[model samples]
Target: MEYTLSPSVTIINNRQVLVSSSSPSPANDRRRRRRRRRSNGILHFPFVFSGLSLRFRSRAVVVAGAGSYGGYGSGGGSYCEFSCLNTPIEPATPAGRYLSSVLLNERKLFHDAVAETLEKLVKEVDEAYARKALTVDSSEAALHRRIAELKQQECKTSVEDVMYMLIFYKFSELRVHLVPPLSKCIYNNRLEILPSKDWELESIHSFEILEMIKEYLTFVIGWRSDFSVTESWATTKIKQANLCHIYTTSILFGYFLKSTTLRHQLEMSLADPIDDIIMNAYICRRKNLVFGHTHNKIPTSPFDGKRERENLVSYLTGFTSDSLAKCAQPNSKEALNLITKYSFALFGDVGSDKMISTSFATLKRLVLEAVAFGSFLWDSEEYVKTVYNLEEIN
Candidate 1:
């Protein structure tokens, strides 16, 4: 049987989507309400009243506090990063729920606990380095020292929450700068978030790092060959569950872009015309190369004879925050060590059954936010390491 929904309910039907918060502010995602077009006093959305089941959230929305910081952009200067720290945030929006890990915290009035929590997680994030830095070679030793000093105003490095808040704030700023006009696709009058100028502009990525990305963005927009590369953008109906995978993949793509860009810049500074950036990029993406592994074999197909569950990590590596540092280049092995253990896991899984029809415009904003996120992470990785000794600066 076919179903009909208003634009709002239609958008919410996409199931189990995930983070990104590419809009002007995390606050903009705070409360999403689907307009129920009343038809004879009954909520008209068939999805809501249908016999098919839907998940309901039990816990009150609670987000961590992002305290003030002087170095970076105001670290959630308002104290509440997602919604005043301790109130319901977007119970209706499936996409915002994937950030549960980043935003989930107790109902506390102050953000001090979050800082403390992040401080403790620093060692956990760098556990491998902490355990092996001294025993390893000079290179790993150097990376440990570098991560020891990675901070902004000491507080950012000391408490990653400040940095996290800064990234959130930064993306909000970009969303304003990169507003999208209504799509020109007559059939796809549905709104998206990137500008009309960029709709068919080929690429939004920087030239310095374009080759390295090599369809890495397949996770976000799908294979370039699958659609008109410069003539038209495709639309997909993403289930909320699948949305989490896409958002996380986009973030990973951002991280990869930054790491490659830095590696390129570093090579340029060396005054040598190295021709293996993409080679190093491929080396960096190898799952086996994680944590100083010397394995250099190309990863087998995501599923080699075995079912997807057997190759789950390899399969899902492209879908979650677990692959942040997996793109370590052969030369700069410790490129991502400073922010190694960081993750973007946030919010509860609330909309497992919903799905959203993602437009090219929405995809555009998501890409913009991701690149911005990667840039900030790279900056923090450099800043935090610029100073050593991993002590909390409270």
Candidate 2:
């Protein structure tokens, strides 16, 4: 017979089974009862809420015979229900946490201590160098000795020791001029301070050296390229221009060598050459009048007429400090005003041979005047500025 099972209930051949039942006595009844029991056992019924009758040989089996039924019985029921266990267990404390914090604090303190020690060492070194307790060569020798001692102590050279050595060395080199035999002192100081193996010198000429000093002077005075006549030419029209570029490059090379005295000397030499170039260019620009000749030929002479001569004199006077104040500030305002005034003075005035000749003479005079003025200015302002700047740096 077919059987269907439901939650907490069992059916055999569409009939419900009682959990408790007594055994049937007749052979037919016993056989029928055994068949029913076998069918019920196949259903595997669980505990039920309500009492249900189990048919055996057309008789009802009650709860009292549940144990005897064997398959569906009250004796098989559990006394207590089970439940699930679900809670998290706490982990044991880690041993490394406290140690790690202490280590971090110690490292920070060590870094701070090292930094303070370095600063003190630097200050002591600078004071010693200043007082001549350490000569440039001696200072360098000391550094080498110290480095060697540190290497022996630690069995290896550290980046920190190297850096400290470099700082002391640089400060000494920078202040070389303050010591005696300035050039030698500076050179020695630089050699001591800089890494010994990495220095190079450029090939240079004397004229070029002179020109460089002049340009350096102008640069310090705040002369803008746009305001100068040299900027207008594609080529360096004057020899001083070429010289200046060369000298400036050379001086820069000396700076790399850490030779303060050599650098100063180069700068000092430039004063005369720079003055001459600036003056000549200024005068040439002032007489640059485009004369419209009757023959349609360009006039060779720049200053021809009485009016041009008067104009030239007036232009020169206007460049004076008092006159420049009517225009702008510092000395640059006067210089710029002079450049502008002269630039416009000769614009498009065409005239006769006599006028052209006069203009040419005026141009020559202006050039000569500029040269003299430049020479004096270079020796005075440019020289002072360079020396002062170097002093400040040291």
lDDT of 2 by residue, 1-394 (tens): 1111111224545733223211112342365446446754221111210222212132221111001110111223311111111000011112122222322355334323433433444444445445443444664767655654443333111212322222212222222111111111112112011111111111111343333333322222212223333321112111222222222222222221222222233333334453454445433432321110111112222222212222221232334333322121112222222222221221111121111111111122222222222322222222222212111210
Clashes of each: 32, 16
- The parts of candidate 2 lying over 4 Å away from their true place are 1-334, 341-355, 359-363, 377-394
* TM-score to true structure, per model: 0.37, 0.13
- Runs in model 1 lying further than 4 Å from the true structure: 1-61, 64-158, 168-205, 210-214, 223-235, 271-325, 328-353, 388-394
How many residue pairs in model 2 have overlapping backbones? Answer: 16
Model 1 local distance difference test score? 0.34
Q: What is candidate 1's lDDT per residue for 319-390, written digit by digit as tens?
A: 223233344211121222222222212213524555545444445455444454555554434433322223
RMSD versus native structure for model 2: 51.4
